[model samples]
Target: MASPVSSPKKNTRNRKLCTPPNHSLFFLSLLVSMITFFGISVLSFMPISLQDSYLLPLLSPSSEPFSSPSFSSAENRSQVTLASLALTFLDSEENEPILSNSVMVPLPAHGIVGSNVSEEEREFWRQPDGEGYRPCLDFSIGYRKASVRITEEKRRFLTVAVSGGLNQQRNGIVDAVVIARILEAALVVPVLVVNQIWRDKGEFSEIFDVKHFKRTLQADVRVVSSLPSTHLRSRQTIETMQMPSDVSPLWIRSRFLRKLNGDGVSILKLQGLYSRLSKNLPSDLQKLRCKVAFHALRYAAPIRELGNRLARRMRIEGPYIALHLRLEKDVWVRTACRTGLGAEYDDIISKIRGSQPEYLRASQNMSYLQRRLAGQCPLNSLEMARLLKALGAPRSARVYRAGGEPFGGKQALQPLVAEFPNLVTKDNLARDGELSQYSNRSSALAAIDYIVSLSSTVFVPSHGGNMGIAMQGHRAYVGHRKYIKPNKRSMLPLLEDTTISNAEFSRAMRKLHAKSQGQPEMRTNKRDRDVLAYPVPECMCKHSVNNDVSHH
Candidate 1:
């Protein structure tokens, strides 16, 4: 108090010593300013309703509008500040169009519901009573009658040499059998042509039951394993005939048979002979094609046993859903369905396109939808999952995938697996040795898939390729089973529409496929035959009716 200026300097020195520094105060002010700025920014962008209702309450606790809160404690003030910031952030996010518009529709828990599934759909899935479950036919009496007719008459031996994959070979064999029966020739056991598709050297007898084949068709046509030694000796003397592309019963009866009479044993060298479903064929010959395809083409003992075992393993109390997801690398490449796979997969698409046949390559001018509608491309895994979910396949359904590992492996199958967690394959169910036996044999592996698919309660094919077509035909022939033939062409647009909600998309799909389920109508026109896979009337008969009637 002696000197005023000196006293002020001493006071300042004392204040500096008592209070540490201005740095802490500066940081606190900066943080509060930043939070206020951030909160204002968030609120400015928020929807008007959110700002008035949600943000207003968080920012000002007092009921009076925009009134600054008087906090009793620092904790109260801090709590209010933190809450307002959080609400601002949350409200801002909630107003985002992407999040607000997205709708994830869950699939039916038990099965598909709604008006889409009809009575025929219900009956198709229902388990058959007693022996009706089995698709076995009694061709014994017919075989015996046909046998007597053939043995009594001196029939000319006809050896049909054909080639292709299993289904193609099977189709060829059916056509060959009908040809032999038409010409009244003793049919040589048809050869299963070895090719790069399966990469197996196994003979026809090695994969198929030669004895069963011979025994089953003994009456309809004499199915000999090979050309008789007598015929082999006179091989050079045998007359060779190339089957005309448009072969008919009239052609076989009127002209072809006369060529076989003078020769030691005519060799009918048939190529691409899958045209047995002609509308003009005699009913008996048509029935014979059915008998051979549906009844007589039984797999060998090992294959049958393995297929059954795999089927049993897949079924858990109820019949499993067989998904023939034809997403293998070769098939995918051939079909050129690559669209939304992204940059990483572009090289793969390019490589695949480069390798395909010129005509099959996806044209640059054609749209993705065009390619898909024309059935030139298969549904990608994601699209397949979406379609299945829409069809009312529950997430918990047991799905047995028929084909090999998909093109993209885990990445491609992720969506399907997520939807159907219980999905399985032969590789997962079968023992190492069991699968190893047919490891290199693609056809045998495919046969296993075929058998499992045949035994499934519901069969759905992702694409209408050979495996799918064969399975569809087999399922139809066995009985009018629940075969969900997806109307991919109709469903594609709905899937591509981002504007549509998940529920809306699913509803549209269900409506589109309402009548497409189960055994489709048998198409009569040769051009439309492929649509139904198996023309039911031509290839299948009611088991009861088949057993009661006797062949002439």
Candidate 2:
């Protein structure tokens, strides 16, 4: 009977039909089609910068998959959430991405990706991967764990005179640690050369917490208060070493290695150590710099207490704006730029600049108006006022002005004060005699400024000085609080145009600064581009989920 049944030739094709339908392959094919259809629409929004790096391979019929790039520039093109992107790939049942037709129809998917979108509005409402990557203040990337090689008998010390004002000295101190590491020598607490302008006698210990500096860098470099007692017998106070500017890691090791080993216990001192070390060092060195600047260089306990107190007072009313108003005599003289306080102020700056060859002119070719428009000069008080107002500075928001005394004195800040009357400096906010204690100590005062600026809800720098650069980097190192770096070149043109209404100017300002909002960015190897300024993808790490901020 079975043979009889078999005689039907088993209906080979029918037997195949009888089996359960294997729809997996069919579904996969359908998915691929759906993706291809919508991918065209998604590809439309693909940022031009990323088009060359990836996506092309993905679009092509290739056997091999696209190798993931180290960074994603998708955030530059669109602040679209990763979830929306996921939904775009998802099956029909799930929440759908803006359909292929929606791209043409221009329906709101989440928020439209463009300059009109406010920075705060673009914030992803959900928590980021690393506990929202916030208290975004984690610049310490296992630096505490990395061990420093200790040389017992032939201990060597690198003494560096960290010159310039507070931020400049801060950078120099950072360089000293890195150079010490490169030379494999212990670092002495940096010597703070009193700045001539501020007449600041603030020592390293008076400015930065020495114990914290030493302990924080114990694993990275041995930081000592001074050379060992044995080295004090030397005829020279500190053996001087001439280091090149923007020195490479190899150059440092090669040049200083012999010097360190020359004597049993040596102390090599170098002054004006700013920009001496290369910016694009090995990632470890860059990170070490970040560790020093962000963590190790804490203000002295007293300074911290005063700074905290002042900061508390400043913010007590409401979240304040830390404006780094660079309107000092030196700034005007050096930049050789106009103040927009009228020809009188400009004439004064010109007279001072012409009188002193010591003062720098950014470029011989760039003239005053040219420099101002080019953003080569610092934003004048009037410009700062317009910018702050255009950026929607709350009429009542207190602005904590950080930097030296304005060039025009109280008159220099009249425009800003008039627009936002709550503009207060450390002196204004300080309890009587509180700042008097550190009166002559500019570094200490700037350190106080630094602390307040770092802790502010919004930090705006009028010019790109050492302090501004450092503050921007520090602000980013912490949570990326609003840092509106005036797009000097583009912005000045907009600001000077008398025809545009306030609303239009505000729109333009928002558009110009949309991407300049203190986003974390890795430092480029461009010659003299400071690493401390751009401390991202090197000093900072982020979860893949936070690719929106990967401004690498």
Candidate 3:
């Protein structure tokens, strides 16, 4: 204003001051432009199904859409802008449907409605990216598959007789193959030995496809339906070695390796091979475990057909939760916990545990509440009811009961049925004569449950057991399907607190399990941890586009 062009230095200083403001304005416009562009790009590239799911909330805010965001708000607009850019990076490939029953697309933090859930509760339920890791089954850079070079003449034989239930037998069979590879021996089909207590005479061929089993493992280890004629006739040479549980490769080699090498064409039968092998092993061996569980050990066609039929029926209406209602008599007595039926049932369980000293746990000294609090006991119906409700499942949620008959029958399930009226099992879901065929075969029925459970929208185990553990791992391998492992030990205390309101309880439950959902965690080196049940660091690799999710 002081004679506009009079002082050149004054004019320059004023222009420099104006330059900073202009620069700021330029950056602000660029950020807003970039954010708008990114958000639009995400919506444009989204699948038709995902577009409906993610955009419906924005069009109509009455769903409490903004209340619990998939991605929480950033501290500032800059952070918001940065987050908008993140949508462009999800690589549309990750948005494909995993299975028909699974979430149409596994959005990082997509939330379901109507129930009171945490901001990122749906993320907890969503299958993990395994920290960007997916299932990878291959030898490392140095490791290579050297198929059995030992001639048939020098090859020894290892036959395993797996005991317990269907899942126990599965664990044993998986270990048997790795054990065969470790010992450099040909593996005969693992026998599903009769459980002395249950007297279940289920055969290997009755459950699994024998030819498929043989063909699948042919490359890694020589597999046959039976041992040679000589060994079959004179089975005495094949000592029935009752192997101790949790045996290591070193122990296996020392115990049987030298013995097998001594005799020409020696055949050894190992009993109690359930959990007989170490959890930790070489990467190649772990991959073999996955190949065995996911690929080789398939249920017979009939079992699969029935299971699929039930699964189809389950998901026909909508997504369902497969609950491993672990309230069996054996589970009760094993943990010595009250049946919640009454003091009478508790006394009966105690007497059974007392009379059968073997059923008496090493932790027998711990009281029933102590065991329940420690999560050693299966969750009874009431606790399960509370859990499902707290986890965002409404009263109308369809639930598939995935266990044998509860000890107390309808009375035991009253609480759960009261909450989730649409509860069902293979019995009700199957066709007229479908379940009748496998009514007596407990393992076959369990196999049916396993099949249906694996395909469920969500799998919630009442307590940790063979079926539950196996399902959790299988779900993770399949597509990181929603597997809610109840925070029993921790949540039990919270659940027991009567003073705490329902709102408080729900918040606590969600918070406790925030990071426990089927995330990519490597199997701990703990004893008896099944690799098939925890196949992240070993079996699964990162950004595994080649690894396809197994719907079967």
Per-residue lDDT of model 3, residues 1-552, tens digit only: 678589899899989877768778999999999988877676544322233233323332332211123435343343344333443443233332111112111212223554664544454344554554544555443333366362132348888888888888898898888888878888888888787555677798889877667655555677877776776655234778677866677888887777778645678777777776777776677777887887678888788777877887887766678899988888888877889899888888878887887766639577767777788878888999988888677676678998888988899999999988999988888767777777678889889888888877778898888898888777776557767888888987787798999888888887887677777566765655678788776665554232222210
Q: Rank the candidates by lDDT, best first.
A: 3, 2, 1
lDDT of 1 by residue, 1-552 (tens): 467566988888878899856898899889999988886676545432223233333443332212233456675565456456645454342232111111111111123345755553444354322122212222334544664676333337665555656777777778888877777777777767666445566677777777666655654666777666775666433545555656667866776656666645565544456654454565456556656776577787898888878887776445568888877766656566673456667578667577655425456788766788776677777888888777666666678988876776788888878887888889989886888888788778878888888777778888776667766665554444567887877776787799999889877887887666663455454543642265444433222311222211
Q: How close is candidate 2 to the true structure, as a TM-score?
A: 0.72
RMSD of each predicted structure: 32.2, 15.2, 15.3
What TM-score does each of the candidates earn?
Answer: 0.68, 0.72, 0.75
Clashing pairs in 1: none
- Candidate 1's displacement at residue 312, Å, is 0.8
lDDT of 2 at 541: 44
Worst 10 residues of 2 by lDDT: 100-109
List the global CA lDDT of all models. Answer: 0.62, 0.65, 0.70
Write one digit per residue (lDDT tens) for candidate 2, span 395-417: 66678999888877878888888
Least well predicted 10-residue stretch by lDDT in candidate 1: 100-109
**Model 2 clashing residue pairs (backbone):** none
